[model samples]
Target chain A: MQNDTPELPIFPLILSHAMRPLPLWPLSAGLSRLAGHILHRHPGINNRIDYYQDHVFLLDITDLPLFLTLEPRKARLRAFRRSAVVPGHDAGISGPLAAFLAMLHGQEDGDTLFFSGALAIDGDTAAVLALRNALDDAELDLAAELAELLPPIAGLLRAGLPGMQHLTGLCLQRGSAASERAW
Target chain B: MELVCPAGTPAALRAAVDAGAHSVYCGFADATNARNFPGLNFSRAELEAAIDHAHARGAKVLVAINTFPTAGEEAIWHAALADAARLGADAIILADPGLLAHAAERHPGLRLHLSVQAAAANPDAINLYARHFGIRRVVLPRVLSVEEIAAINREIDIETEVFVFGGLCVMAEGRCALSSYATGQSPNMNGVCSPPDHVAYTSEGDDTVARLGGFAIHRTPRGAPAPYPTLCKGCFVSGERQGHVFEDAVSLDASRLIPALARAGVSALKIEGRQRSRAYVAQIVSAFRAVTDALAAGREPPALALARLAEGQAATTGAYAKRWR
Candidate 1:
């Protein structure tokens, strides 16, 4: 009676199925909305970059197959996913997830990241500098903002999204063990 | 032991109180507090509200007007202490000897605690502060071992408070002029250490370099975390060695030594992060509350879950144990 539970399914298959319908475009769109909402709440950020209204910057997350293009629109900054049809960005910044996350959350120093070469910027250095100054002026917490955006799952993702990763890892390990038993 | 917590803002003060802080310490939005960081600290109205909030929860508020008085600006420090009294602070923490004397005379009824910035390491200094200015407690500098602390407690009549967690200053509390040498901002005077205005960072090939006052303090490889531009925690080159010369970028975490500190006759446990956010204050205060509550219940303290939040992802017992020396 105690051992009547069903075995866990394979994590890779479940993840694949879950992510298959939701491609990078939609995911990027959702992220852009979230970023826009956060940026909109802090008007000081926009004021810092008011001079760079014409510049569009692309943030390329090297670890993840995603990029966000940020530009000023209608007196407020808006972020959108990069696509073939989209106009070329004034500057393109590339770095690992940590660097981008740190910069986004106002946790890491952009100057330090660029100086140490942890992040790379191409096309327009002045645009990137403006972006950095604006970000520094806005000390936004990405995790907190994400939590606010999704109140129901706020507690589940404290200190960033590591909880989801841990849960996925646990599911994967259990699935692998079940696979071994079947063999 | 009483758990004294730091609150740089009104929100942080409420967080600390809600998290079971026995007492919450804060400073005005001026140079009176040691953590004189930009966008930090409270206004007079904020402190009044904070005090009311803490008092409603059975927690106390201690105002720290602990910065050293400048040559001609003695009136400001005196006014800070007087205002602390006028604001009905449970206690006022002071560092400068002249300020302490002024507070003792001007506000005779106000409780006075010696700030760690005073660096009263020996019993002689502690006794003098207690005798001359009626200091109720002395926040011992983060330089002594548990045994040394116990020895000092045995001789001094005043209560002893020791920093149990948060940032570690390698230099003796009040004596350090490192920040002044590098950035011309005095920690003891300006209430700022490694002021953010002078800090800068740059990317060099595959590493991230953190600069304070145009000097490279830390340069971490790509993807690795770069240390905050702290002068003392900077990587240096000397005699073919290139590493954190003065001290590693580690936060003080003496949670494991709560019992030892209690045994050493420590009256209170101080956490050193007034410049931190409300979320950080809440988490740390609640965690330390559990530890102190466990100690009171005669149970083992919980495993430390705070290492992840520490600077450089590392925590140490600091000078509490013999290992530091």
Candidate 2:
């Protein structure tokens, strides 16, 4: 089988990274500030990606001009135009997603692309698919840029929790398993 | 006051019908049905026989074509609706808007019961279904409490059905993909979730771990009785927390809440397992039958009797309590 080994899913990878209660994972508000910083440093890669953990990001164009956030909570990248910052865990994001957004920020028009099948979208499929056609035109390899930009956050998390990269390191070591009643 | 129950096979159908179910619901053996599990549902011949058996016993039969129709390929679903209408079934449970439109136009008199998949929680959504497709009753999503159901009943003209037993999905019906994310198959698309075919129970040393799509959900001692790894009930590590983050190994049994549900204006009560054996079906249906009958006669209700059936799995009133919100 040519595509035999399913590419290690980036959706779960980023989610596992963001699963921390630490103040490092950038939320929506923090993402806006990060976006502003990127716009200043790498003006070429601004507002061309939308991030979601629902199923997958339905990027209609490889290079779009908006970053939509759909995980942990429902928020969008363009939301920063008004408030620019939000309270709570809005700013904390895993290093992987931050790297991906930075890649999409510098895309050109008419770039249609599809992510791997079933990207862990926790929301409605049709609603997200309906919004798929609205994508900005740009060209940047999200998967590649993520690797380059993730080193700092990775070091920080690894330092806080020793040997945190492997599967065994992510063991549920504390807290109520999950408030079963909260379901 | 009819009690519609799920039957995954002819034997279960007979069990439900024999157990004094006012009505029973099942599906054709294909993707057209929601409980499209392996070794479940009925063939065309089996469906006819099931309907014949139910009708002879004075119990009704409903055929469910509840999963959403795939884009650009709705012919399969449309034909299922037609075949169901032709088979003289009591009613057809439908969810997709396009499919409902198709059925309403083609089989105009074919009765339509809104599947819980429609998620018509609010009056506006319910009214939309009623006005456009003339939907008669809606199997309300498990997300609502009894008080909310009464409030909804007050505002809508349609009858309502509430789940009283079996598997529980924590998310709003039809608005989730946790299973499909881990395993490629999904309830809304392929009609199965965390599909049993993809599940593997492996012995890793002294521990037994339940794996769905190769991800570990829970690991217990090898001697422990491990449950199937359903996504909602699966254990996950989030920050420092681990355990059943979404739910536990419990199935829902709101048998205790039937009276409250009755008072809340629910016209019918539904049991969720279409995949159980004949004897299990008989026991549960019989118990609930007596409960509803007593409630109808204005007599004091009997104490609950399905504790052994609930087994080690805990039972909850589920979203009937708003703590889930």
Candidate 3:
């Protein structure tokens, strides 16, 4: 059976590689702001991950030359170059950006991604599980969340999301009927 | 035969129903059921909607209040029973004897099924529940062989439901306390086994080590697929032996034995994965539905390649054939 699952687009990889020469400080600051915004919007996410408040989570986007460290206690999300000697973290989840997005959009199962070797978890499995569970409950939409944060781009983002989703075969929204049918 | 499916959320319930499930089982988002995990299960309102959706599709909804209640928290279980009956659940699956008694006495009109958590393996135990609590069905533990199941069915009067696919419990259901020994939470009491709060995976050299409550369960080579750190399916050093001393990291796949199970007088085939995603529920339920339909039509059951959905991409018949023994 020809696997109909869409392959990760090269556009993101190209963009990620282009950003490799950029400074990490601005990205870290932006991510921190976004994290704060998400927390403010979804207070339940904070409460869900409260058990891992003392722990640090590393989100490794394998396709991108970037690594993100999330500190729930501090409400901080810092970014680092993939090659950087990042400080120790309690747990780490590494996967392609699409896998992460698919999970966040409720398109794919977290355990399925892990089982299929599309994602890998190390360090603290419990902490990773807590984060995953929290996110699952949150039902995040990166595009919508970003649009809400930056209203000027809201219309463009909302209009472009479907096109991007179709091109990438990524479910960018929660309860996507197309993704459900594709399954 | 009935096709019983698991639904952790309202979406999963709908998916199971749309995929041709004869019945779907779910639990409230609490410790009242064995699959009490974070971000899983339905709220009361969700359960109500789910029941309506399933019923609208000519399917039944079985609510699972299968966990054993705490010493002083009997009221919670009782409330769950009352609420399930009020929500018009086709049946309430129960594991505790006291709770079963309460349901039988208080909700006389409601149908009751013995949870696999009750570990009612023998005819006497099953018949005792049927005779005492008026349970119409019993979800048998995954520890019995097909021959043993047939023998038990010949002696027992109530309908029998057996797990057809998904995660396998190495220990007898309702009795395993390895999770409690490691994490202080058990499926029987807390409705979770190898509770996620205590499970961790860390990289050691070129290998990934999965642990439950700091107890090393399995270590796999880096980049290789690793199973969940379920205590029973763990690797341990027992004396000089250094391997999975208890059971391998494999999920149960009894699809091949549907005919035998039917011939053995099984009433229903249950799929074990409320914690799984709706996509998984739909795929699995549809596959089993096809198999059951084939059996009913007197056609050969189609070869189903479901290993991709199985744990660690491996499947076993478990104790169904007594081959492991």
Estimated TM-score per prediction?
0.71, 0.62, 0.86
Name the runs in model 3 displaced over 4 angstroms: A1-13, A21-56, A69-78, A83-91, A137-183, B238-240
- lDDT tens digits by residue: candidate 1, B97-136: 9888888888889999999888899999999999999999
lDDT of 2 by residue, B1-325 (tens): 6788878767567768877899999998677887775445677877888888889889999999999887877888988898888888889999999999998898999889999988789888998999999899999988889999999999999999999887777786755677777877766755546564566555578865667777888776643434435777777898999878887766678887888998899999998777554445666788889988999899877867553344223567888975752
Model 3, span A1-183: residue lDDT tens: 111232444336566779799788988888888888887887657665766877889898788887889997677998888797865788889888888887777667777778666788877666787677677656566777898899999999888988987876666776654234311
Q: Which ten residues in a row have the lowest lDDT in candidate 3 chain A?
A: A1-10
The sequence of per-residue lDDT tens digits that candidate 3 reaches over residues B1-325 is 8999988767677778888999999998777877777656777887888888888889999999998888898888899899999999999999989999999999999999999989999999999999999999999999999999999999988899999999898677856778778887666766557777687777789887888888888887775667766888888888998877778778889999999999999999999888787667878989999999999999999978887778776788999975663
By TM-score: ranked, best first: 3, 1, 2
Please give the TM-score that candidate 1 achieves against the real structure. 0.71
Cα error, candidate 1, residue B17 (Å) = 1.4
Output the better candidate (1/2) by DockQ: 1
- Residue B153 local lDDT, model 3: 94
Q: Can you list each candidate's DockQ? A: 0.06, 0.01, 0.31
- Each prediction's RMSD over C-alphas, in Å, is 10.2, 21.2, 4.0
Q: Give the CAPRI rating of model 3.
A: acceptable
The 10 consecutive residues of candidate 1 chain B with the worst lDDT sum are B220-229
